[model samples]
Target: MDLSCFKAYDLRGRVPDQLNPTLAEKIGRAYVAITGAKKVIVGYDIRLSSPEITEALSSGLMAAGADVYDIGLCGTEQVYFATSHYGMDGGIMVTASHNPKDHNGMKMVGPESRPISSDNGLNDIRDRVLEPFANAPEQGRYETLEVMSAYVDHLLGYIDAGSLKPMTIVCNAGNGGAGLVIDELEQHLPFEFVKVHHQPDGHFPNGVPNPILPENRTATADAVIEHGAAMGIAWDGDYDRCFFFDENGRFIEGYYVVGLLADQFLRKTGGGKVIHDPRLTWNTLDLVKAAGGKAIESKTGHAFIKQRMRDEDAVYGGEMSAHHYFRDFAYCDSGMIPWLLIAERLCQSGQTLSSLIDARIEAYPASGEINRTINDPPKVIAAIEAKYSVGAKSVSFVDGLSVEFDNWRFNLRMSNTEPVVRLNVESRADKALMEAKTEELLQEMDRLNKN
Candidate 1:
């Protein structure tokens, strides 16, 4: 009866109390009833409760006359890949991503792997869960689907494997599902992988696999330095988003990776549109333009970026948060594809990752997303916007308040789920100015929050 798992983009909540096999079954029925999906590809992550929940969900799907193709023990993107790769009617991934271990949720996609978010059929399905469900006269069949070979082939297709030479790379799976795919890919690639926390353990011994947190990054960084790796990569539990660390063991900001990927992808395609988030722009814009590609800004979030990629026919889309979407991959974000491309870049260029990123950092210094706990985020944002907009060369609100001047720019946006204000500031080739402006802005926000 508790459907609190439904969210703006996907379903996420504490398990059983908010999400259980009983509720998952009803949700399966509601999903089939609302979306009219005849063939649904279902996948689950490495969580203790995932198998049970997935079984109940499949039962409901079959009961609702929708055949189920279960892709067992996979990442969220695998569901996205299976849905579009097989031309299925829809797909659902049972994953809570980086949420606490006791929590579980689902991310759903309709035909062509388009997201089914709150504005779309997600809300409808949530409402339908409250209604009675009658089984169809003919129950749908259930079958196991083995999509790894095909999915791995698709991932490798994004890179020039022949150009990839021998190199040592560090990949920290954080005891999530990414290690499974890395094992599969290892057979084909020449790169030597120093695997850390590499296993699909639902128990999550090294914590919850979220590499974004500073504390969670130490293991990966330490391994990269200890092993003398070319670069290090880390992924969340479901492996939809991946984080990067250079050979020097410094965690590269995701914003820089966005620019690097845009450049790498654009070179292969000759010229194409690159979708990016507005929080940090100068570096991406510079690289995109130099690569002879057009840059389009989209509001942050996977659904928004994916939709924008589809609309613009973009070759690649990336967010500072580490979600990279590819046109060839049905406009879905993939943690696997980004790293493969980076490996290829390193192999072909014969340059260290830090050398490539350092130049760009010098060109555009950024405050890599600072978060502040505020009582009234909206009031603080509006107040900050009013004061900062006075002499700004340009101002816009594609996602939040973004103000630009000749030498410096900053973006202040409130978190959708919390009373936190996220701020990003950047300066043209001046880290000192960027730091100063960041400090000044933080001080102003603090001053406004008190008022």
Candidate 2:
């Protein structure tokens, strides 16, 4: 097994090269041994290589004396749900999650569906997978199980199905695992879903299954405008993250969605702590405080966010990247719950999706996360820090370097999953100022690159 395949949070690498069935089997065996898990749940996404990987993983797990409950083709979160719901010892989801078709990986969770990140147990698994081990005397059993019905029930439990309005909503699954769940959800929802790229094609015939890229977002936005839909929803390949667009076909930044959802939860539950990432904070902080709730800042990334949420007993947590975590959902991030809650919020307020978030957008104009590829990320980060620190009122390193001034602030940090530095800037209710600062930062980044 290539140790490089193991990342800080999960196992992700190029297929057939960095990761393959052989390595996958070793990973399975290692996971079982490391966690000492006797019973585990395994699931795979709609990727061409997933079935083969799943088979190898199961073989290794069974060899390690683990009773494997194989939940056939599923989203990443389904494995998380099944692990906790079935009271299993652990779970693994075979998916690359919006990576190129040539890429594949795994996300593992221990009992209670808690993540097994590098700090917790991933590194141990990596070391064990490289070492030799003998199989158990008697092989454990493997069984196929269906989790969709229960999964759908769990999703429905997030909001009142009877309260949803009968309005057209655009759903662009990007030909990933989301279509199957959306199809199942339709039977239980009142809204009319205009499906786009709504098939589980492992080939990803419709561009890479990521909606965050501006080039990949046109289809969903156009569909919303063309159909006069109330909103548009899109998801990554594994359906672990969900993105939203307003009725006017405007793509809503996940930053505002954090505040919107936090406000909704706080209002309903009568006030609780809301956790937000450090990337963009003014909006979420202002909204949470206005709703009589406290806003806590957590580092970015699912494992970190979930851990912090559990620590604070936070009612809701959101990353500006569209990863929403709910305390009720075992503190795991879910792409399905955010939309359902937003739809329910729309139902209760009797307001259009666009109208609900318009005020927040105006109150805290932000430059949505802008990613830049540079040879020296650290040098640029240092340069940006030096340039801003002199006049900064406050600075933080909760997740990344966030420098705040009297009316504006920006966060610059390297991405854990990708080879780029992400920058987010926001000004207190001033779009022009936010734009100017964003440009200034970009220019600085470019100058450093030239040097």
Candidate of highest lDDT: 1
| lDDT tens digits, residue span 197-270, model 2 | 99999899988899988988999999999999989999999998999999999999999999999988898789
| Weakest lDDT window of 10 consecutive positions for candidate 2 | 1-10
Segments in model 1 whose C-alpha atoms lie over 4 Å from true places: none
Against the true structure, what is every candidate's RMSD? Answer: 0.7, 1.6
Cα error, residue 356 of model 1, in Å, equals 0.4
Name every residue pair that clashes in candidate 2: none
| lDDT (C-alpha, whole model) for all candidates | 0.95, 0.91
Model 2 misplacement above 4 A? 417-419, 449-451
Give TM per candidate: 0.99, 0.96
Superposed Cα deviation of residue 229, candidate 1 (Å): 0.8
